[model samples]
Target: MWHELFLIPFLTGLLLAVLLPVLGAYLRLREEWLAALAYAHLAAGGALLGLIGSLPPAIGGVGAAVLAGVGKRLFAARLSGGAGYALMLLGGWAVAVLVAANHPLAERLGHAMFDGQLYFADAAMLQLVVAGTAIGLLVLWRLSQQLLLAHLYPDFFRIRGLSAWPTQLGFDVLAALSLALATMSLGVMGAFALVFIPPWLAFRRAASWRAGICWSLVIGLAAYLLAFSLALYFDQPFGPMLAIVLVFFGVLIA
Candidate 1:
């Protein structure tokens, strides 16, 4: 069961490491916030859904991710990014509260949102892994170069008579998808840190985009390995174990 938790997120992160740069380039989104928002919504929504339903966490996670991505894009079109994110967070919290209130099994619901038990994974979880990997690979293959170009230079892309909007929209969707997969596999902590810290550590050490991506991949995989090993040995939560791995490497690198 624990291995199941590790394998899905590990693979998903590896795929994201390979794909995000290209997607960013094509989308012309210079800021990382787009991806961050997409992932955040997915993590929050997945947790809420898991609390309310018997559906596999991954399914709930993925569905919420998709909804959040669409909702965020619409919100951003009308409002500022900050406002959109705040609204999404509030909405997620409300849903969680409502779900917890209505359920007779409120205790189980609360645990599902905040303290996912990775050791409880079963065959359905494996199916989610397979599905997520497949969808991610397909999207990456289709949009890599466009995303790279767009993110690298939105104004230049516009000057070249290319519209960056489609690329941005595509990346938003991909980010949500990746977040859903990671959240379902490794839970919220795993997804959140993977979205933030790996890129941060890589950017600190790297001077170029390519180099940053390479470093992010190394750091992400190393963190996962270290976290899994520690969790197995100490019987600790995998999320905190992974966080410690990131912090340890981050401090060493600093």
Candidate 2:
């Protein structure tokens, strides 16, 4: 278990355990939590398409998500209240399933994407997770003030003769990258669970916004560690175990 094979995958999951919940906290703040699932589904679809096209799955997945994030700005007015994200989720799911049904390899890859292949994660995944985490934290730190202002005081930017387009676009790309990478590592529902569950509990229980973020990180990290151990011990799939553990944590706190 302590070999390089397990150690690398564990480290990959560790980075994501911390990163996904932080991203989730911000998404929840903006009332855009659906972006997580949308991006995950899209990444899964892109990954399957990539496998068929002989492109690197990560490249395909990330490329598709980044494109959607950038393109979202164009349709922002027409698709209010997450309707666009919901559409993306449904479209991506349909594409992935259709591709899987038609292609033998895609079918196997689709199961892996949904069920997760964390124990088989290689050093390349660790590198990607490490890079993604660093970039995500840096972007979040630099844009944190603007992001809060944009959400909490929507008029603040408009009143100050500032366009929040750059900030919104930057964060959208950041979120797309984070969710796509997480979906690849943790599977669709597993990644969405990490993004959805911990921040949810924190929002209800924490005293302040910053406190909610802190509590979200703590809950996500704790649940991820427990799920990793249990899944290994029981010889079960890690993704479902993670989602289950997170829901159980939510139940306990609720």
Candidate 3:
């Protein structure tokens, strides 16, 4: 009972603390923070598809994210940002509800994905998340130099023969994959909070890249701890509570 209810929740929060800040910082710097919500909805929709069709959860989640990423890339030249991302977010969320509408376990699954009940997470699921996050961090670390150059010196790339498409593609794929994994592991709400809140706080205060990420990690960890403690004491849902905690801190810090 303790393991099922407490241990997994704690572990998941810890894992998210370290992982999300890095991913969040990258997204904020890239000006793709809105895409996090988009990918999260896509992951939720894809997870519902997996449930309805008996596919692997990650397959559906990652597939939807990749499709969205590709679509964004293709339509970026045409569609304006606000309209494009808004339509995609609505589409993804609508698909999720539609998929879950007639399922036998609709309520339960919907609650799981939307609420992200941390107590219900299993060890295997948590481990998979940890492994995936680890690999993602490594990939980001490897691309750090190029990503910095691209962000700070777009003209520098054009001056060279570097089209920069490959770098963009790599980052997009990684972000999509990370969003998918996080959605599956942490639920849509949890994933959004982790990806959005920390970075929002980090960017406002930090003077340098390293300082920004460090502060993000600190803020994320605090949010996770506070949420966990509050949930345990008040008998509330961990993910939503964490989101609330993050918002509270965001207000205070802002």
Candidate 4:
């Protein structure tokens, strides 16, 4: 049942990775809020999944997401870039420590959270995935205008009687939820990388939002397919291999 729930986030992340940049661009978003939203969703999803698994989901997912978000908000104001990278490293270490401390349950849940043997996926996991995907899509559709407005001109949004704070909070919650779900089913490493990398690369290279999304989707699918193939051939972990594939392509693109 849980494994079935995994597919929803996997497909959702893939779709969002491909479409968000383009959507943001279309709506004239100036900041990287869309990207931030995506990451937040991934974090939230991870937390939720942890909770479902009877693990300390908040400690790892919500806690880490909040910490990472706060750190990014703080450092980004001072540093030009690299805040995300720092957060990623810090979050990884934090999760590792927590996992190590929990040993027994961690070992079992870790395999479920990271290894994700797709062949063994069950019906319940699929249902969860579908439900999550539907909810995410609905939220995205409903909030599109507000999100765009907030991104483009936060001050104006405030003036027009729209509170940026609420929007931000909502986005954060949604992001965390999405992340938690994806992490539970797809494996943490693969899910996180999938959420972050492709959009980033597309944003870097593509001139328009549509172009960026199209490129991102192509790249994301390619990365995952390559990763899966490599993992199968070498008997390596799928999540790490997927991340490596993304890195390899990222470097090549760079």
Candidate 5:
């Protein structure tokens, strides 16, 4: 039972506890919250590319995310919040669907991305989740203060012997890579799923940034466990079950 029901959720929740809050904080600080969904979509498309190109799905997802991050940064140079992101998102999804249509594994791949077949995850995927989460958290931790300074005091941070534009862009790429790794576990929704609520809950109530981040981790893990039981009782899939439970938790806290 532990192997069947708990393993994937446990791994996912633990990883998210570390990775999600950092991504959320960065997105909120950078005022680029919309990019989360766009990058997730790009990652999904890249997963499709992986299936077609014989690469690891997460690798493809990260590749797509990096490209999207670079393109968005370049385009943002001219027009802040340009239409390029919307186009990239739509084009990515369209391409993924079109490509999937030609392959026999489309339905399975799509189901895995959106619905998250947690019970069927392989050993390689489990390893990916652990390694990805560890790497993502370490990078974010090392850069957190710098990233925050860049976000809040861009000109000042840059004036103090730092390059704000490059730093911000680098953070975005790292964020996309983290999000892509998340997609490997929670599916397409994995990237941004369960992100907004817990972090919002913590950031709203906590006294300091560090405290807020800690609270966010607690909220996410608790929600995942509660949602796991609810999924079993209600006979529902885990991803959407977790989503619903997260919203419930949000409402309760509110």
Candidate 6:
């Protein structure tokens, strides 16, 4: 399995294993983890529409997610907290299923998006993941302090006569892009699992914010590798296996 054929997909997964958890740590901090599932579901819908229109699925998915992220920020007053994400999630799911129901090819692609087609990931997917990971890391590095202050004190920037929308919007777009790519590679629930579980576990155990991030990264990477190997060995689906492995890890730690 460690041959030329699997190299690209493996590399894609590895990069996501590093990036997603870092994003997840922040999402968990902001208590906005539901955004992962919302963005993923939207990506699935966009991907299905892309197939129907003969466009690249990744482009459609990422575009839709980024739009939603931007819109959420712009309408922050009305779409506050998880309400906006919930709306996106339901709309996305409805769109995806409705599209799949009418088109045969879209049905298959939609299923693949939810179930995951990691082994079928091509070079384009790997390249996209590489670029996304790099951008995510760079932006996260710069926004670390602002994000920390925002999450810890919600009013830190506001009280000081600064708007927090810019930072929140930036992170929102970054997270939307990250989850879209992960969904394309790891399936909807697989991506959500990575964004939710590791950080949940890390927050319970870590002594500080930095330690939480480190623990989240370690937990995500370990589960990802184990899940990948186990799925390949057992000839099972990757997404479900990854989720299962993560849950088991969560149980062990909890």
The local distance difference test score of each candidate is 0.60, 0.91, 0.80, 0.56, 0.72, 0.92
Q: Model 6 reaches what TM-score against the true structure? A: 0.97
**Which lDDT tens digits does candidate 4 get at residues 1-254?**
12435444345444433333333332224344333433434354445446556756534564555555445544655744544544555555455446545666555655655564443334544555566566766776666667767776668776787667665555544554455455554566666676666766777898875577577677878887676667666876666877788888888887
The better candidate by lDDT, 3 or 5, is 3
Q: How do these models rank on TM-score, best leading?
A: 2, 6, 3, 5, 1, 4
Give per-residue CA lDDT, model 3, range 78-136, as digits (tens).
Answer: 87665666777788899888878878665466667788777766776678678877888
Give the residue spans of candidate 3 off by over 4 A: 1-5
Candidate 6 structure quality by residue, lDDT tens digits, 165-237: 8899999999999999998989999999999999999999999989999999999999999999998889877
- On TM-score, the leading prediction is 2
- The sequence of per-residue lDDT tens digits that candidate 5 reaches over residues 1-254 is 46645666566656765677667766766666667767777888888888789887778888998888877787786656646657767877787788778886764676677775454566666677777778777877877888887766767764677566666677778777766766656655545655666777777788998888888888887887787677667766667777777788888997
Count of clashes in candidate 4: 24
Preferred candidate (TM-score higher): 2 or 5 = 2
Predictions: Cα RMSD each: 3.9, 0.9, 1.9, 6.0, 2.3, 1.1
Question: What would the TM-scores of all predictions be?
Answer: 0.78, 0.98, 0.92, 0.65, 0.89, 0.97
Off by over 4 Å in 4: 1-96, 111-120
Predicted structure 5, TM vs. truth: 0.89
Rank list by lDDT: 6, 2, 3, 5, 1, 4
lDDT of 2 by residue, 1-254 (tens): 78897798789998999999999989998999999999999999998999899998888888888888997878899999899999999988998999999999999878988997678678887899999999998898898899999987999998899999999999999999998898888889989999999999999999988899899999999999999999888988889999999999999999
lDDT of 3: 0.80
Name the 10 consecutive residues with the lowest summed lDDT in model 2. Answer: 116-125
